[model samples]
Each structure stands twice: as structure tokens, then as C-alpha cells.
Target: MFRFFLLSIVCLITIPGFAQFPESKPEDEPFLDIGVALRFNYNLSTWKEDQLERGGDFGFDIFRINVLAAYKGIKLNAEYRHYAEGFGGGMLKQGWFQYDFSEASQIQVGLNQVPFGIQQYNSNNWFFNMTYYVGFEDDHDMGIKYIRDTGRWKWQAAYYKSAEDLVFSAAEGSPDRYSYDILGRNKENNQLDFKVVRRLGDSLAHELGISTQGGLLYNLDTEENGTRYAGAIHYEYKTGHSLWNIKLQAMFYRINPEYAPGNNLNFVEMGAYGANYNVANKGEIYTAGIAYHIPLETRLLQGITLYNNYGYYNKRVSGFENSHMNVLGALWTAGPMYIYTDAAFGYNQPWLGPEWENAFTAGTPGDTDWHMRFNINLGYYF
Candidate 1:
């Protein structure tokens, strides 16, 4: 099934070396590393008049701190971000503690990444794929996870007791977060997530996997529990040591909320990044992305990754419209400084347009025009 899809879409791009903590040697003792990063951004969006009049707007974006430590058999990873006040105040990306049961198995607790989708991410762009808006990609929840790795097979199983919510969710001020999650009257709870990946090829050039998550949607209105489920199959490939990366995934997701009588059943409240919005109860999303890395030898320049990613959402409900997002972007790296320039185009996407309401759920049918945001982000890590 996937063999044909992989062959047909073996187009472009690949994952780059993500920031990783140094591993402790068998004979070594405990070690700790802390790093800091400051990122700035310039944006040209059609929706912002102040930005358009000036040809764009430039300012500080975020400052983040990372901590990684390992001792004996225990390990730790965490990051904290301080964004501009306009983008909410501060947020914790993830903070998890793990205990290794040999190299093949381990367990983690605290706010952890959900074991779903193509590992941690798909596209290298700043906005990620459209699935991010629907509370799927790069999602983290207060949970516990068990992981096992052996041969060509890898597995992850997690139980998220509840979606990440600090303070009051439905209160006046919503949560400012790094990942989208269910918020408002209906909350997410007792989610069970499991994923299995198999690496194929002599050099582990190909990866195939499936992921599924199911949980209860607890409604504050009715004081009853509904249900939600998401399932997806993904395929990824690389040319061992080459500069290209390819990833494709198809996902089906749905939410059945038992709201109080007369409440809106078609949409659920989803929030992230200091905001709240409605998301369709059911939808199917498809994502495909490609990128290529070009390494340059120079004093001021190092490497650049040129890539394109596309995502589509087809809702299974009426009075709702479909959505599409396509991002053409590049990532440039020079020492501790990294730059991301992207021309992101979208149809009915909230972040991309004048449609500020129901961009993910109801989708403005009148807003048929396409929107674009040209964004450049520069960050220096130390």
C-alpha cells in the first residue's frame, strides 16, 4: 500500500539534525547542559495593515532556555520560553524525566510529547502543517509514556491524564502554549496513545508507522463525558547521508462531545499560543512535505534547507468548508544563529487571513480568497 505512495511522492526535502542532548558514556558520571536562545521575527501579512503599510513588521519574538541532564540511569529534558507579551507571556514546551531500562526501553513522566504523527514533526517551517491548528501536530500533554526499541521495530505507548491546562482554561485568560490542545467547556482526559514504527532498508532509509489516540471529552456544561479518537498512517524516507527528506501521512480524527442541551455540537473549543478557536468535530487531514539541504563552506554562511510542505483538511460535516495550506520555506544555519524564511499560503486558515473565527471548524465560505504571510525568523542559540 505504502510502497506505491512512497515511490510516487519521492519528491524533495528531509529532516535536519535536531537539537539533542549529549549522551553520557558508560563510564561517565552525571552531566548537565543548559542553553539559551533568542529569536526575532519579521512578518509581512496581508491581514495586518500596520505591517503592510511598512512592507512588514520586525521585532523580538521569543527567548528560550533548554536544560538537559543525565545521571546514573535517569535522564531529564526541558525547555522554557518567554515570548513577547503580545504573543502571550511564557510557556513551557516540555519538561520530562526518564528512567532508562537499558538502551532498548525506558519510561517518561511529566509534561511529555504525544507519541503520534511522524515522530515529533514533519515540516521544518515555523508554522508547521495544518494539522497543528486542529490539535494534532507537536502536541504535548500531562502524561506518562513507555518506550521500547529493538531491531527494526520501535514502539511508544502513552497515557495522557489530561490535556495541558495551567490555571483555569475556560476562564477569562486562556493558556499560552507551545502545542494546541482541547480547551474551554469540553476538556480532554484519559487519552491512550500508541504508535509503532518499522525502519526498512539496510541503512534505515525508510520508516513506516501507524498511530492512534483515543480519550474522553469531559464536558463542563453537561458534566458528562464524550469521546474523541484520532488515527493515522505515515511513511518517511531518506537517502542515507543524502540531503533530501520525504514524509507523507493520512489521518482521520473525530470528536463526539456530550454537551449540555442546546450547546453547539458541531464545534469544539481548541486553544494554543495564547488564543482560543473552534475546531470541527470530525475531519480528515492529509500532509506531504519535502526538503533539501545545501551545505556551503564559507566564513559567514554554512547551510540552507529549501523545502515545501502542503496540508489539506476535508471536514465530514455540512456547512463547513475545506482548508489548505502550502508553505515554501528555507532554513539557514550559521554557527549558533538560525534563520527561517517562509512564504506561507493558506485558504481559510486563521493565522493566514481575515477569517478570525471558526477557521478550523466552520471555515469561512465567503472568505474564498487565498492569504499569504511572508515571515522570517532569526534566532541565536548559546
Candidate 2:
């Protein structure tokens, strides 16, 4: 399917007559923006012994290249990234084309971000909220979406072939990078998602919306249906460079497996904080965060922002304990470079990483019940 999508995109770009887009202005040149981001990171504490053994303490975060081109009302965008290890040598993070039907409406196709959680997370933390690990925020999939804004309201809806392909592919002996599947009980299935938002007022505005997903997931030879529901609210107060924002969201899911011999349980892999922690029959997830941006008057910096996020995972299955995760971070924007530093802490958060869980459960009196990470990320964006 990935190959087919690539081929279709190539055909669209290379087709003799179709390549000519209608010009919005005959005399104006097409607009293009190219950007590159280099990340340098340091891990003060990995919170896992195995990560240290694997030399994961410090390294380059990623080498990213981005391109955006627009002619008339037609636009093309792509982002490619190179990781240090595991996953794959590199992958396409986003590649999509957008055609505007009007000033406030557009159609997008290709691999793009799924519109589930906050439009663009308002968190100043580098890692974003925990919902990200569970595929709620910043998750991208190959699909087509229609989006529109009508001054006071916004609408988005999409259908995806699968959650995503290459990003979920396993590396070496480890499991897939992400544990949960939006497809639910079927190995391959389609998912429909819709979101509608209404905004109130201008300054000190209120934004509320709801979104849902229905699909299938697979287990062995049998497939099952799975469904999810979620709702979100965001509040913002902005006056000049000083801004305050808050976000709240909740999600619940259930899986119904087909009755197959030897298949007794409907399973869903729950991932947290970038780790596949446990499997459950059903679960509820709650997430919230607040951010404040303080404009700076210094000669070298544009702003200093602070943010905090909290997440709770409640598993309904027995023998599974709930987990909590949080992050307090700050960002300093100086010219084209941004410096981010944060302290992440988690409790009973097996999603912190498998190796960390093993160390915590090893019964050593010295093992800490909570995990902590002191992280710093330096990104130069152009």
C-alpha cells in the first residue's frame, strides 16, 4: 500500500498535462520554502540499565529535511527524517498535497497527521503529552482528509488505510515501535475519524470538540472489531506576547474479538511515554496540560515559555495497575535556534521503557518506585 501511494504521488507530479497547476496570479512566481533541523541531545538519566548498556545515553536526535512549495492554491509538503539507531535508517514523516477550494477550505491527501487531539499541541515540552505515545497526538497516517474553517467553527474528517506502515515496523528482536493499533482487531482495515470544533469569542476564547474512531484489529487468524470515543476542550487567553492556554481530553476504547479456538481474550496493546507497557481488554485515558508564554525583551531571545502536562492511564483488566506521567519543561527561542530542557517523571508507568520496568520490578531495595529523566534538546530550525 505504501508503494502504491508513492507511485500515485509520482504519477501526479510527473503527468504531462496534470502537472500544470492553474496560477492564482499569472505574473507571480511560485513560492517555495525549504528547511532543515539538526538536533543535539543529552540524556542525564535514561532510567534504564539496558539503555545504558546499549549506549543510549547521548547522541544526535535526528536529521530532518522539510520542503514546502505552493503554486496558486496548490501546495506540496514533505518531511524526511534520519534516526540514530533502531527503527529504520530513515523514513518519511509526512508527504502530502493540499488543494484549496477557497480561502477557508482545503483537501489534503497522502501521509499526514491524524486530526484527533489538539490541532497542534500547545505544550512547550519537547516530548509533548503522553497521549502522543498512544497515537492520539502528533500521529500521522496515510489517508485523505477534508478540512474547513468558517470563522467560528472548524471541521475535519478522514479515512485511513492503516494507522501507519514503516514507523510501526519492528527493528531487530524488539517489538514494533508503537504497540497500539487504531485498526483494533483486524490486521488490515479502514478507520473513519471525524472532529468538529466551535470557537467562542476572540480573546479568552473557548474551543470545544469531539472526535471518534471505529475500525478492526487482528489477533492470530481471527479478526475483531474495535471502537474508540474521545472529546476535548481547549481554552486560550492571549493579549499581545503574553499568552495562557489549557487543554483537557479523555478517551475510551473497547475491543470485541471473534470467537476462535484458543482465543479467549480481546487484546489491545497500550503504549505510554514511548514504551509498550501492557495489554488490556479495555481502558480509559485522560490527559491535560497548561502552557504559558512570556515574551522576552532581551536582545538575543524572542520568548521564554513554560509548560506542564499530565496523563493517566486506567486499565480495566485485573492485575493491571494504573499509570501516571508528567513533564515540566521550558523553551527558549533565540533567533533560529531553540533550546529545550525538561524533567519527566512517571509512576507505575511501564511505558517509560521495558528495561526501566524490569529494573524497577527486580525487587532490589535500591530501585526507585518512580522514574525520572533530565533531558535537553538543542534544535536549529531554518
Indicate which candidate wins on lDDT. 1
lDDT string for model 1 (1-382, tens) is 1111011111112322234544435424665666678889999998788878999988999988777677666788898989987677799989999888877898999998899988668676888998888878888899999999995999999999877767655432265888888787877889999999999988887999999999998887677899999999999876649788898999999899998888878888887778888888999999999988898999987889998999999988898998899999998878667888999999988899878668877777765778999999887777
For model 1, the superposed segments whose C-alpha errors exceed 4 Å read: 1-19, 26-28, 168-173
For candidate 2, report its TM-score.
Answer: 0.78
Q: Which ten residues in a row have the lowest lDDT in candidate 1?
A: 2-11
Q: Which 10-residue window in model 2 sums to the lowest lDDT?
A: 8-17
- Candidate 1 global lDDT: 0.82
Residue 377 miss distance in model 1 (angstroms): 0.3
Candidate 1 global TM-score: 0.92
In order, what lDDT does every prediction score? Answer: 0.82, 0.60
lDDT of 1 at 213: 95
